[model samples]
Target: MSVGKLPVIDLTPMRAGDEFHKRALGDALREACVHTGFFYVAGHGVPQALIDRVFAASKAFFDQPMADKRKVDKALSAANRGYEFLGGQTLEPGAPPDLKEGFYIGEELAEDDPRVLAGAFNMGPNQWPAGVPDFAPVMMEYYGALLELSREIMAALALSLELPEDYFEAFCTEPLATLRLLHYPPQPAQPLPGEKGCGAHTDFGGVTILLLDDKPGLQVWDALNERWLDAQPIPGTFVVNLGDMIARWTNDRYRSTLHRVINTSGAERYSVPFFYSGAPQHEVRCLPGCLGEGEQPKYAPVTVEGHLREMYRRTYV
Candidate 1:
C-alpha cells in the first residue's frame, strides 16, 4: 500500500446552510491553496453511482480492440477531439510518451462562436462511436456536472485570494474543457527507452480534477522533497491540482508541479481526469490583490487563445 507521500483535504459540504461550515472550508482552501496548490476534494456533490457508471463505460470502451478504438482516433481529425491511443508523447522535451490510451472529448460548439472556432484543442465536436449506445450523452452529462463543480471551487479560490467571488466567473463561462478517459494497459514485456504510464508535465489548464482508480502509478512531484510522490486514490474524493494557467493568475503564488504516471507492477489502470480551463475567449492576467497596489505585474496579460497556442508550440512541436 506504500506508494508515495501525497496531500489530501476534505471539503465536505462547503455550501452548507451553516455559516461556520462555509468559513472553515474557505479557510482550509486558502491554506492548502497557498501551500500545496493541490488537494483532494470531498463532499463534491457528484454521486458515487454516477462515477462508477462512467468508469464502467470507460473500461468497456477501451476494452475494445485497438483497431476498433482507432476508428475514432483523435489523430484522424484536425479537431483533436477523439481517441488518442497508447504511446502518444506528452509533447514535453526529452520526456517519454505516455503508455496509456485515451478518449478525449470537449464541448460541442457551433462555428459561429468566434472563440470556439479560433481557440485550439477544445471547442470542436466529439466523435462518437456509432457502436456504443448512449456513450456520448452520458459522458456529456458527467462533463456538465464537473464543470459546475469546478466553478464553485473557483469561487472559493477567489475568496481565498481575497478577490471578488465572481472575479473569475465571467471569464469562465462555457470554458474550454476536456474529459479524458484514460486506460494504461499493463507494462509491456519489454519497456521502451523512456516509456511510462505518462511523462512528467504540468497540466495546461486552470485546474485538473481527477477521478482515479486504486492503481498506484499516478505520482505528483513533491516540491519540498523534490521526488516523485505517489498519489493514491481515496474513494469519495476527487484529486484536484492547480495547473499552469491558475499559477499564472495567482502570480506564481501557487505551484504547478511535475507529475508522471508509471506502472512497474504490470497492472492495467484507468483514470478519468477533467481539465477545466477558462472560457476560450477570456484573457488571463494576474489578479489585483495578487499583484497588490502599485506592484509590478508579474505576468503580462494574455488571452486564453494566445496562452494555449504558446503552450502547444512549446509542448507539441
Candidate 2:
C-alpha cells in the first residue's frame, strides 16, 4: 500500500460465526489495526437500500437553498448540529474554511442527565431543519440501523482483543453517536490558497463509520510515508477508521493516522459519516492485553467526558 493511502480490506469472513473461521478474521483485523487505522470494510451486513436512501436524502437536503436549510440552524446549539455552509469549516490550523457544507447529528439525550452537564460529553441536543419533511424520521431510522451494525462490528473488535465479544457493550447502551452529512462543490479552476473540502485531522471520538459517494478526492494520511493519498469510494462498501480513544485504548497498537479531504474533482462530492463515541465521563484505559507485557502503558487513564470537553472546547469554541 502506498504511503498515506488507506488500505482496502475485505471484511466478509470476519463477520462469519463459524468457530473454524475466527483466526482468519482476527489476523486480517490485527494487520489492519496495527498498520493502517483506515480501511474499506466490504461484506459487513449493512443493507444497500439503507445506504442509498441516506445519500439520496443527503443530496436532497444539500440541494435546498442555503436559506431554507438555515431555517433550523445549529446556532441554537452553538453549531453542534444542524447545517454547516460551504467554506465554513476547518480542522487544520492556519487554513481557510473547508470547501464543503455539512450537517452534524448525534444521539438525543436529556439535558438534565449527568452526561448533559456543561462539562459532560453528550450535552448537546440536535438542531434540525424543519423544512425537510421526513428529515427527522429518515435520519432516526438510518441511525438506528447503523447503530446495530456498529455494535456488531464492535463485537468483532472485542474478539480481536482476545476478550469476550461483549467488551464494547458498555459504550453502546445509550451510545453517544453522531451522523454527519457533507457536500463538497467542485474546486474552482484556479483555487484559493489554502481551501480544502476538509482539513487534515484525526477524529476525536471512538470510531467513525463513513459512507462516501462514488467520488474522488478524499485522502487518508499514511503515517509510514508523509504524503496525501486518495480515498476513492466503492459501491456497497463503507470506510472505517479508529479515533483518538480507540487508539489510546489499544496502547497505540492501532494507528490513528491523520486524514483530510480535498475537492480535487471537477464536480461536487458528497459524504455522510456516522461517528460512534462513548459517554464522555467514562474513563479510558489501556486494556490488559494491549499493554500488559512488552508494551508498557504509554498513556495514563483519562475520563472520556473530560477529554472530549477539552477537545471540543479547542475545536468548537
- The residue ranges of model 2 lying beyond 4 angstroms of the native Cα positions read 1-16, 109-120, 292-295
lDDT of each: 0.78, 0.77
CA deviation > 4 Å runs, candidate 1: 1-5, 110-121, 292-295
| Candidate 1 global TM-score | 0.91
* TM-scores, all models, native as reference: 0.91, 0.90
138-240 in candidate 2: lDDT tens per residue?
7878888779878877776776777777777787777678899999988777776777778889998888888888787778876566666777777888889
Tens digits of per-residue lDDT, candidate 1, 1-317, equal 23563455555544653556666666778777677677888878898888988888888888888777889988775668788867775644675777888898888766566755675555666787766667887898899989988898887777677676677888678688889999988777787777778887898878899998877787777676666667778888998988898888888877777777787657788999998887877888887667656777778999876788788787766
Worst 10 residues of 1 by lDDT: 1-10
RMSD of each: 2.4, 2.5
The TM-score obtained by model 2 is: 0.90
